[model samples]
Target: MASTEAPEVLRYAAFTGDPAGGNPAGVVLDATGLDASRMLALAAEVGYSETAFITGRDEARRRFSVRYFSPLAEVAFCGHATLATSVALAERIGTGALLFDTPAGEIGVDTVTGPDGKVRATLTSVPTRSRPAEAIEVDATLAALRWAAADLDPDLPPHVSFAGNDHLVLAAASRARLADLAYDFDALTAVMRTHGWTTVHLVWRESEGSYHARDPFPVGGVVEDPATGAAAAAFGGYLRTLGLVTAPRTVAVRQGEDMGRPSDLTVEVDPYETRVRVTGQAVPIP
Candidate 1:
């Protein structure tokens, strides 16, 4: 049974220090009495790309049980929501390390105030994996996106990457190609449902360590995500796996610029483990 009282919800934007930027997420720090149906209803009402509900907590271990939901359905994990929740927790309690028991796995997060006095959170994701997109899937996706093969970057091939949630990675040849994002929403949504993809990660590599990204999250009932931490983690894993970037390297991801809300994400990778680390600052949205 769920409580009749309305749960207190907090709104925060992740991957940026400015409230006007980044991806906004609804966070319910004390969702003890909420059931799955109630959680889903609250998430849909909030109208964010993703919302996080913390059901159980372990004070001794600083651990929490978290569930993620989009406007439409529940998801395995959501990185932006995790960052938002961590920042929310850090603001209330002292900032340090925290553990989250998500459906994907146990994720470790660290929060601290930077030299600029902004709260930043770093999340270590679960093990990640990637697989090349099949020809049929790619063809259908391309048709839905109205993108031609010539617009694709030759260096970065198409792959479906997973870091908690799955994303279809498509590297455009130029910044212009990436910026012009007018896709068939229903068509892409159908394809995403069929493949169980959270978002379509459209990116353009600017330099060896710098890249620009845009995410289409039709399944989440959102046209685009301002900042996508999950896709960023999966991208780091994909780069290391494909040897596009070496281990122990840091990649800078610039996103949401085209949408008027600019956000930045830092991705770190190592050769020793499959888990990718994503770091960014989050700000409360008043």
Candidate 2:
């Protein structure tokens, strides 16, 4: 059978209202006939961190198959791409609830039009989990980042956390530390690949519910991610696991300022559930 070409891709930035401040995503509104190779090629051509392909939908249009691709490979799930895709769908189909069947698991996204008539996307991830980081792994990661163990935030120990994809959570003692992100990309990528980490979540906790964050995604062939939904979800799990925040609390993550693309992520933890809810707005890139 002949393969059909994919639909034209729409580009959008998620988590920030400004076009210059959020993570860029490629949204293929309809990917009925596109294959994995085509999607991956398209993603590489777009050169964004991730691109989302929307496959066929169920009878109610509430359930759909979604695939995510990075510049170099396909990811199990992508938070920023999910948000961008939801906002794009909301602009056309109107906002409500949508379910995505990703490689990792089912994800729920709710879209609501704000007072400004802008659609905001909220994604509820799979059940979250975390484990202590091995001493050797931590040391390797630090060496790749060119930082000493003392530079880490004592309150937030290193750990591997997952929402949809896995990430290593490393908290900085100060915002300055997070801002100065100079690391050996290849070295970091090797370490991340060894541990099956998607990205390194570098964070600085501002308060009980607010944080400043940066994500190094050398493994994805990107130096850094302007907006990271997966890392935010993982961080939420980390916060809950460490008893840093009570359940049913909302945490805000401020990211991308250092890279000139400022983005915001709102994470909500349910009292009785392990899933993390991440909310943000996405806008079309001009």
Candidate 3:
């Protein structure tokens, strides 16, 4: 990567085994000499929600320094891109444990090949955290989304959650409410920039351990994210913190179905651990 040669960017769709069913991300396995400006330019060219770059590596420790960039700017962390990068690495280096030093924190990734010959990656996120969203902030967000307060789920409440990056979590009162997602992009972008929010994690609880989600990522210069592992990680903490779900639970998230690219993610929360684990399969996009 240090060389001046053009970097080889690989494309992969994360959270689904099918190439067309998940979030697409660009992976630059070797990005040694690429500067921030070049990386950002490359990310914009790749044009996914985000692209992952491998800037440094340690062979003995199976560790690498990684950075994620959205089409607009650099991001603190990106779960789908992390999964894509891990699988891209595993394809060449063989599946096993890999550690990534990210701007947010150290992320632990484990990759294994399933019986169906698909590579599945599980990422362990940084410590999760959350706080109640201010009333004004909620009101502004609701206004931007064109949703009423009645559309909010009483049980979930409004909170800003963090698992590397900050996200505004809003639960829908019903599935229909979640499905109707026409919003003022510029207004929501303004609100997110003001609050340092990465995405608006709009969701609906389908059952005790299952949910559907849609993430508005205007901050990332994207209309929506097909699958959002970082938000799912933060949500696990939100659920645990609110006593909505008991610890040692696994939550199934179904995203992108409404967008035509269905994605599935499994989030695991441990009783004693603060970090959340998100697992999904990634496939090369031809």
Candidate 4:
């Protein structure tokens, strides 16, 4: 029998004002009693891309310990969940700074009213890093996606990037290449598991500080993610690592359009700093 007492879950879609757009996330403001199994079950029931549970809190510092769950597993960190959680907290406690002690590291976020009069949240990730993807791994990944090396963008090289979680970043030469996203789910899942990757951040850069993105989350039992915070952070790091963009700059990411759930992300890179900041607005999903 299922437990009668379950924590109430708040639903929010991050990165979009419209409830029907963005990535849906389950936000549990207080999860003191929820265990791993319970959280996972709740996530499965919610059927969102991911769910965030706030376990511990410090009123003085406005800090909390947050855990993230997908239907099948726990992730070290999640961008969408963090954004959702921050907005949820802001609604209750009012807009301010919130610190999160995530599995990956301590992250700081700020919630403030936007010019449009809506509450928006921004999270500054831990130090970001990136490395060249191994040739063998790249080959395997391409095989799983049924993509050829020639299809890759010469300007944007492939790399394994990390801000909170690791992501394989690949830039498509054209928007068409990015739009046609057919891949072997099982094969990609196997490769992602072996590589300890959370998602594959496929992108087509439109211009400096603007790009379209798609995330393949086979490892999490999802074909594609409408919006991915972690990947955005990592991709910001990738830009910095490659000197693709000047620091102290903000970049815009448009994702989930192909899936019909559009999302927007703002990534800020500080000069001489490794941490990347991602900001977005989340609204309740009726």
Candidate 5:
């Protein structure tokens, strides 16, 4: 049985200090009485890319069991929502380290208040893996996106990357190509569903260690994600797996510029570790 009463929902924008500058997410601090159906309904009503629900907590371990729901379905993991939820909890419990047991795996997060009085959260993702995209996968995705092989960057080959969730990595030959995003939503959704991919990580390199990115999230019931932490994490893994960057490298990803809601994400990759670290700032939406 689920509670009939409405649960409190908090809105926050992740990856940016400004409320209107990043991806928004709904957070339910205590979803004790909410069932899956209720959570899904609430998520759909909120209509964000994803919503996070904290179902259980272990005070002594500083751990909590969290679940992520999109407007259409439950996802294995959601990075932006995790960052927003961590900041929300830090506001109440003070900034510190926290562990989240998600459906994907255990994720460790650390929150700190900077001298500027902004709360920044860094999340260490689960073990990541990547492999070259199959020829069939690339052909189908290209058709769905209406992109010709010539439009893709030869430097960065297509690959399927995973941190917590899978993302198909595709690099456009030029920034202009990345900016002009118009695709068959249903067709792309079908392609993603076939590969169990969460999003298509479309990116173009700006400079050394800097890139512009866009994500199409039709499966999540969103046309585009202003900022995508999960995909950013996977992108880091992809870069490392392909030897595109040296070890102990940090990449700066700028997204949502085309949508007019700018977001900045920092991804750190280490030579010895398999997990990727994604750091961003989140602010409450008032």
Candidate 6:
């Protein structure tokens, strides 16, 4: 039997240039004839948190229609995968703006080489919205995570924010709390399923502009996300909604260190808008 897939898929690590760091995502740059089942199969074969499939393209406009699949199901939008895909395209097509027609909305990405000679990319998210988390929902989440009320940061209240997907924003009281991430995966999965949550954004604020984050994504069949660009974008909106930070500032969210895959994401927010801009560089994972 021969595989009919064309334009061989590429592997890249997003949020960090180091091959060993960042979250790995499979990129099918040209998924001309690939269907939903085939894409999911490919993603499972790749065994990454997610895989990005570019179904349609406009060479003249440098635009593409992208779909994301996890090992289990499809995703509305995936920031790390988008970054990985942009980096892959930039490596071959040269750095510039690329448009993506995603399930969530149309997104614009710009790729550029930093002063250090790394190919970095920035993605602008769709309009974001945040609402207070219901008491029962928050309580169940805290219990599933094995965290207590004292473990939460008093300054940052519990909220559910959405950019491309829904995520529960939980602020831990200390870095130590965020570091120890032994949670009940099944319990969390059940809670998330009930609430339609993609990830729980566990965070510890190091400073006004610096933060540490971990995402438990049991619903995706992953214990934790190495780097979560979508959650970073949502967190930016969360901060804005809560009046936690001044707008038009860049906040750094560090993740994957505890998992031994240190990743960095820069989230920018403007005072007047609800969209968040996330930036990071990716490298091919050979």
Estimated TM-score per prediction?
0.98, 0.97, 0.98, 0.97, 0.98, 0.97
Q: CA shift at 273, candidate 6, in angstroms?
A: 0.9
Poorest 10 consecutive residues by lDDT, candidate 2? 1-10
Model 4: lowest-lDDT 10 consecutive positions: 1-10
The prediction achieving the highest lDDT against the true structure is 5
Per residue, candidate 1 scores C-alpha lDDT tens digits across 1-286 of 8897889999998999899999999999999999999999999999999999999998677899999999999999999999999999988887899999999999999999999888899999999988888988888889889999999998999999999999999999999999898999999999999998999999999999999999999998999999999999999888877877654888999999999989999999886679999999998999
Clash statistics: count for each candidate:
0, 0, 0, 0, 0, 0
Clashing residue pairs, backbone N/CA/C < 3 A, model 6: none
Q: After superposition, how far is residue 173 of candidate 4 from its true place, in Å?
A: 0.4
- Candidate 2 lDDT over residue span 34-68, tens digit each: 88888888899999999999877873767889999
Q: What is the lDDT of every predicted structure here? A: 0.93, 0.91, 0.94, 0.93, 0.94, 0.92
| Pairs that clash in candidate 2 | none
lDDT per residue (tens digit) for residues 24-136 in model 4: 99999888887888989898898787999998999788999999998889998999999999999998889999999999999999999989877899999989999989998
For candidate 3, write residues 113-146 as lDDT tens digits: 9999989999999999889999999999999999
Candidate 6, superposed: residue stretches over 4 Å from native? 1-7
TM-score of 5: 0.98
Give candidates' CA RMSD values in order. Answer: 0.8, 1.1, 1.2, 1.7, 0.8, 1.7
C-alpha-based local distance difference test score of model 1: 0.93
What are the per-residue Cα lDDT tens digits for candidate 6 across 1-286? 3246555779999999899999999999988788888888888888898899999999789999999998888999999999999999998889999999999999999999999888999999999889999999999999999999999998899999998999999999999999998999999999999999889999999999999999998888889999999899999999989887664899999999999999999999886888899999999998
Candidate 2's displacement at residue 61, Å, is: 3.5
Candidate 2 regions off by >4 Å? 2-6
